[model samples]
Target: MDEFNGTEINFHCMYIPFCDARDCDRELYDSPVDCPDCNRGMVALHFTILILMAIFITMGNLGIILVIKRNKIFHNSFNMFKCSLAFADLLVGVLVVPSGAYETASIMMRSFDPTALNRTDYLIGKDVAMIRPDSMCDRIYQEDIGGPGMFLSMISVLSVMASIFHLVLLSIDRFLAVWCPIKYNQRKALKDKCAISMIIFVWLVSITLSVVIPMSLGQRHFIHGLSPAMIFTLKTSNPSTGIFYATFGLGLPYLALLGLNTATGSIILIKHRNLVRRSSLSPSLNSGGRRKDEVKATITILVMIVVFTLSTLPAMVAVTFYNGTEHKKKGDATIRSIIYSTLILLLVSNSAWNFIIYSWRNDNFRKALKNLFTRKQQRQRAIIRWKQLKCSVLLLSEEKRRRKKLIKLTEASNSYSSEKM
Candidate 1:
């Protein structure tokens, strides 16, 4: 049996090793892993999914932004929150998804051409025959900001965290709107400043937590030159840091979102039920349309909350587990990696699909978007008609001026002839 070491298990392309039996030795080929064919298929599938997600996310978020910007009807506090969320999702699509696709493509390419992997010193030692495979593969860990890949990772992390914060803000906004309409109205009047402040705060906290704090911690860890055991014990194995980080970063916000959404949803349901009962008792009530609109809005919010929870839960569980665990076996690590990757894709999909949810659930939003596009077309046509009308008027004025000049010339000629005679 091949005894898998940490380095071998931690290699990039864990599903498909770069060095085959022909390139390296029997040991590389003897590893228990997914078949190369299946791995290639999986890579292709992942790349395709990510590319599609990026496209949808870009288009969807941009559409939401355009719709909100163009339509004055959507300029409320809740829509402002939606706009912020869309912007954050847009960043994920633009920055994160493409980067992930590129990395997946790189892996695919390396899988096909193993030599490309060997070209790097970190993958291949000075001597081919005496290549230290373990050290070579181990040196190239992920998420180190020494390159563009890591920089994208950092941005993605920032955007994702910002997005989650925006979601929490959105939930709170909905809660207040449903639970306290008068107070919500007052707050809504001051929404512009408040929304901007909240957005700025979200980004600041996201950057501090994801980038500044991590970098500082890493620097301290490196500067101290602690042993692996000490590092694990102090940082990874420390339950306090893990608990605090997980709770604040992922757990608490999600819990708050869930609670707020639930409360808001219940309030909406009760109000809707009461409205329905009243309308049934008095068929003359004109609130049927308004009730329908309210129901649509409530459904949209509930769908967003549900999607967010579903998409985020897996990654949250994986992170919390990894952070809390002292030691993980090779199989466990591999499984966690796969689970984490899948969950990340789910998270990206969550961001991408919110626009669809809005479109599907909210008739007003859909109509507003349709009207926006329709109005754009009408505006273009109006401009063209205006230009055409202006041209015709100018032509008619010129014709009149020319006729006057001709009459003057003819009259002058006649007068000159008569005088000569």
Candidate 2:
């Protein structure tokens, strides 16, 4: 059976250079034909948008990293959350962006030559590509597909999970800092480090589930008969898959952050409000700027929550509802293009907007940024002044020497005249 299947698999793979099989039957399928309009304009659009996103995200996240690393003032508990969020976004760009680009390219490439895709072979000949879940033949042949699509999808999922998990930690940190001030002040650094470690653990666990388990042993699919001839496509589907992801990656963390942010942030706001009321009513009137700083911090934290939610929720919604739509095979390009553009914009924006949100909304962050830029400007001005001074000094010294030389020449000429006389 192995020898016969191996011969059959080679025949199927002959058309697809990238196809390989580990646990799939190869003899039952034929080579697929090209997909005329599968990826079409969408692939180009996806690539363009992805490339631009990669560039924009890289630059923006780097700015956030620099701001945190370079400035001590931006290293507070809440600001630390901002930095961690930025770092997570940066990791997404670093680890997942290229794979996203590749996935887009692969879909586009397969559209052009669907039958020639080696990834398509595992998809077509085996039980991998079909969307149906009940067939025992499909059920029994679960371990057949392995390729870049699966790998990239796994990493992308991992990045998303990390982003969500870190956001939760960030929200919790802000919550604690606001609602539990005494505790926050006492053990801020140790708590922050521990939170960071927990974030790392989140990523480690997420990667294990998202990437490692599925690749090691999961059912894969191959799309058949989408083109002029039989064509292969790769995918995976399980009833529990979406639920599992939603529960662990999306649903749980989202609720955790939202609940904590709302509860703790509100408590802080109310307490501070009462304090302000008392201060305003007091006879001494020496409360200074305490109320104002407190109010500003509250507003800043609120804005952070709002911005984070707005930037990320849309993509999550899209992901959640992705399996619901019954898109046509022919319209794959259009659908993917639209979805990809929107999703990438949202995801990338989450990373890109943190700096502006933090700087504009939080007084501490704003002041830190102002001081940084001011110092930079002052240094530049000092350099310019030094350069001007050096040039002026050189010019004046040269002029003095010229005057001395002329005087000596005049004396020499006088001496020569006297000798002649």
Candidate 3:
């Protein structure tokens, strides 16, 4: 299924990877042609990673969101970036996983029937209404999946960019807050940041390509390749713009994020060590709890950046090498196949690894997990307290009412006795 952008014109593509044994392997070849064993392994590996990505990214991000929402201590400007990064990845996992899985299925089905795409569409009720000569089951796969796959890639690119930018901002925020707390706390200075505006701008720029690029293609269902549906086409000497975007959007920003965080975090940690050493002389330094928190946050961001970089770097390098001018000359097909397979693994793993970093490195994250699980205990305690208060209030009200009633009765009886006398 797919939809256009809303009032702001956000476009979306939903796809599932459904390549069969031959095409999967053949994708890495000089031309999209034959290769059986490589294709099957590729397909199997993609599907397997898709399942793991769905589970890990989704659950991990959900945990982060839960922690951020629940823990007041964790709720700060810097944490907002982490929340956004996790959220974007979470969404990417949700959108991409099924599409990837479907793509794998589409590929597999392709071997049995050339018209496998149309046949898949028929099962999903996505037929073009114009009958095509495909097996009914595969119609949706043809019309919907491929084009949507490209669009999904575009969206994923945007999400990744947003996540990176957010991380960068987070690092900056921490740097300011730690190094210059007074300035950071000032209303005027803090207000100047306007993170919300930055967020909007980032998303707008990111979302712009999906909506506007189609204008070049002239609002077609999908392009067969890079051919724009409309009149305009961008000719570039660089052969692999799409691949470049995919790699750079994820890779370069992460590299920058990692560097910026490392430099800033090291400075903060050094300062913290100094503060700790001089803890005896300065009463102010005694409240070094904030420094500790800063260290923990820094470590978490640094670890996340490292893990994301290492996990995804190989694929970026592989794609760059594969798309290089010498690729055709240097390739044993076997080596090329190996590179593509490795790239796929990296790409799949990239979407899933952040959660693992949090679980392993972040004490706050672990505490948040504990809080999430033990929420029922907290609720039970609250309920018990409420019940006791309610009971005490009821008893006090009953005693007061009884006293009033007795007083009224006695007054009435005394008045009657006086009249009779």
Candidate 4:
């Protein structure tokens, strides 16, 4: 049995490229080396994916923001929350996605020694080093201007957290409006101030979580020694921190959103059922339009909640379990990388695609967006009409002057002929 165990261990060691324990140490392999062709392809693919995602996110969020800003109909408290969410998503697209893509592309294109271990490999095991030198990492770290990478990392986290909080606020607003109509109407008087206050509070908390805590914890883990992807996973460096973040930062908010949305959905359904029964009993009291609006609003809220849950839950789970998993084998490492990238992409898509959801489910928002475009077209047409009218007036005046001049000349000629005769 002992001989068999020794043979199995030897076979495993033979398959590992650098099975020597000392070769895995960080200090020993600080030189740069060229990446394999497969890694290069992965880098290019991921970069293209991220760039496309950024473009979509930017355009979608910009449309949402512009629609809300231009249309007074969207100036209410609920829409304010939506606007806030859109703004956060816009930041993610502009700052986070591009920064990540650039870093990935740069890392892939550069030649490096294949002995240095990046942050992820270092975290998993000292034995797993990238087949690249540390010089590339050093060069990237030096190129950072006033820690732009760190700033982008914090902004990305901040925006995503803010979006989730804004969604929670929106759900609460809808719940109150539906469940307690009288109270909600009364509170509507203070809606503007309250909305502003809530938005400020969300930003404050987001900053504390994304910027303040991470900065205090030591930025080196993210800014100096880590890959762009690893920066977002900073919580996993320590088990306690990961638990704390998972429990408070993500898990609690997710549960709260789930509970609030569920309650809202239940209330809306019951109200709808009651309305249906009333309509059946008194056919004359037709509230079809109002009832339809309510149903549409309910569906929109439900769809938003479902999308948010689907996009964010996997990332939360991955963050929670990342430290506990074993990623020693190359296959396991590759799988882990793919999973992480997919989850991040999903989260980004959630931010990017909310505009589509709004346009699809909410008639009012769709109308508002349509009206914005329609108004622009109308204004252009009005300008052209005005110019055409001005040109016509000038031509008419010129014609009148020429006709008068001809009449005067004819009169003078007639007088001259009469005098001659």
**Best candidate, lDDT:** 4
Error of 1 at 265 (Å): 4.2
What lDDT does each candidate get? 0.59, 0.52, 0.54, 0.63
Q: How many clashes in each candidate?
A: 0, 9, 34, 11
Q: Which one is best on TM-score? A: 4
Which window of 10 residues has the lowest lDDT sum in candidate 3? Answer: 225-234
lDDT of 3 at 284: 58
TM-score of each: 0.66, 0.60, 0.62, 0.70
Candidate 2 per-residue lDDT, tens place, 265-308, comes to: 67766876786788756533433354455556656655755776
lDDT of 3 by residue, 217-304 (tens): 4323322211101001111123455555555555566666767777777778788678679868774554467667667767777766
Task: Please rank every candidate by TM-score, starting with the best.
Answer: 4, 1, 3, 2
As for candidate 1, its clashing pairs are none
Off by over 4 Å in 1: 1-39, 107-145, 180-190, 219-238, 265-292, 319-340, 370-421
* lDDT digits (tens) for residues 16-36 of candidate 4: 111112123345333222323
RMSD each, Å: 9.0, 11.4, 10.2, 10.4
**Runs of candidate 3 exceeding 4 Å displacement:** 1-46, 110-146, 182-193, 209-286, 320-335, 374-421
So what's the TM-score on candidate 3?
0.62
